[model samples]
Target: MTTRDPAARLLRLLSLLQSRTDWPGPELAGRLGVSTRTIRSDIERLRNLGYPVAATPGTAGGHRLGSGARLPPLLLDDEEAVAVAIGLRTAAAQAVGGIEETSLRALTKLEQVLPARLRPRVAALAASTVPLPGNGPAVDGDVLTALAVACRDRRRVRFDYHDHKGNATLRDVEPHRLVSTGQRWYLVAWDIDRNDWRMFRIDRLRPRTPMGPSFPGRSLPPGEAIDFVTKGVASTLEPCRTVATVHAPVTAVSERVPPVARVEHLDDQRCLLHIGAAAPLTLAVYLAALGLPFTVDGPPALLEALRRMSQHCAGAVSPATPAMSASQPRADAW
Candidate 1:
């Protein structure tokens, strides 16, 4: 004779119930490797959790989960549910290219099912979310779903990608993961065409059909998928990369910067930056606007350009004495 722990046995019963539509008392006992008596007790625990489990007796009898009149006990606590609702609502605003509509639909359903006590908190959080402007083009939500599926199912994806310079190329990749980096999303995968790993910003992709075939997956390299994409997108992939010596501590400007931009501290008052932007002039203007003094490091042209712009913004760039500063506080003051 064997005796199984009650709670563990109860969880096993729930797992059995979730796996199929119906199971006879004997069948459940056999699967759990427990006795018929234990199976009956496990059913009690599930019922306590609000699962609408029903049983019929005799040879035709079995255990089945029925539709309940109310929501079952969920795994998440109040704070967790509120966070999920807020995140989904935020996603709906992103209406990312392919999935906005679906996100809105899912969010609507989740919000509808919220319990009376949690409703206000979820509602308030959803109402207060404000989405900022996004870069990267509109990405189709369907693409996200498809990529996600491929990752989960260990399948392959084929798509046409448009590069930074607007060059189109066909690709076949084994999608290992999806990475959302602020305004944009990316996929990290093993590229079939190049025979190497690569990262793609989802908006820049146009998936090709008949999709692609699943392949044997390999372990992903160190680092999170999103960080890998962040480094790729914010680094040298753009038209140009610029490094500037900003005369400010890294901490002072870290929060005000984008993830694509990198900063290294220079003593207590200066930091070096590695940043990418579409145009050299645009890059120069951005650094000049940082409100901190900086020395342009390279691409001699950019240095000369920054100097010229500095002269253009001479009055704007200079600090006025505290008295003169306020009549017109320096736009660069902050």
Candidate 2:
């Protein structure tokens, strides 16, 4: 039999090791078309490179890759490779701090090496999808990772946080889960000082790691993590509220409005929309585009903006003269 290159043999051995929980020595040798001795040598080579390949003692024992302090290169199957590449492409479009550029760079590298058959699949999916850019603040990738690690390891973490008012304060918390809402990332944690659960914006967090001691995990709040974060965000809205009664059913209008807005049914045919925006004019424009006739019940500013917009729209449609001579061309004439 022709001798295989040591590098190629080692990579094959590593791939086999990564694909399953364990492989007996003879089975690995048979699969690699090598002797048991070569399998041992290749396993040693992997360990020397910092991949913790562990061997068991009995006849049924084989080798398995064990966890290490640092992440090793992933060996993904075809489906896994496509999934990861697609995920990286999606992450590149989000506002996750410094990682946006990093994700794109990694995706480029991965796509360059994808098998010929898989490359076009990934490219096709990417070409068909369009991701709207998020308007939320960017978060630090390292801080995001640290918090995630703390959550998984059940360790408490300390960080300096700034509130909506930009008031800086120190926080010590037991990290639980990290939630992403496309526009923003949030961390739901148990605040040690306050003795309550709090949802924090990832952008507003500055985690100081060499994290605190581990704590016993507890059940999350009554709702899902996303729900907790949503409620937390809703509580911080500005005072500029816009309430409008729309001539549409609650279900129909609710589907058109953003999840942050409130839709209360006035009856079977009408619903009240409670929305908040920094600018009354912005709210007015959004309401106008809802395609349903609505009456503004407001803080006066939204009403004024809507009224002004209405006048402009009315003037735009009304002709300069009520009567036109037959010789004059009609407005709707081609």
Q: Among these predicted structures, which one has the highest TM-score?
A: 2
Q: Report lDDT (CA) for all predictions.
A: 0.76, 0.83
Please give the distance, in angstroms, between residue 296's alpha carbon in candidate 2 and its true position after superposition.
14
What are the per-residue Cα lDDT tens digits for candidate 1 across 2-103?
A: 336776666566766766788999988887788787788778778887788999989989999887877653445577778888778777667376466777
- TM-score per candidate, chains pooled: 0.65, 0.68
Expressed as tens digits, the lDDT of each residue in 267-315 for candidate 2 is 9999998776667787787788787888876779988988998888788
Each model's backbone clash number: 7, 0
Over 4 Å off, model 2: 1-9, 24-42, 48-50, 67-73, 221-223, 238-334
Any runs in candidate 1 off by more than 4 Å, and if so which?
Answer: 1-75, 108-120, 123-128, 162-168, 204-228, 234-237, 247-249, 265-270, 316-334
Error of 1 at 105 (Å): 4.1
Cα RMSD, each candidate: 8.3, 7.5
Q: Give the TM-score (vs. native) of candidate 1.
A: 0.65
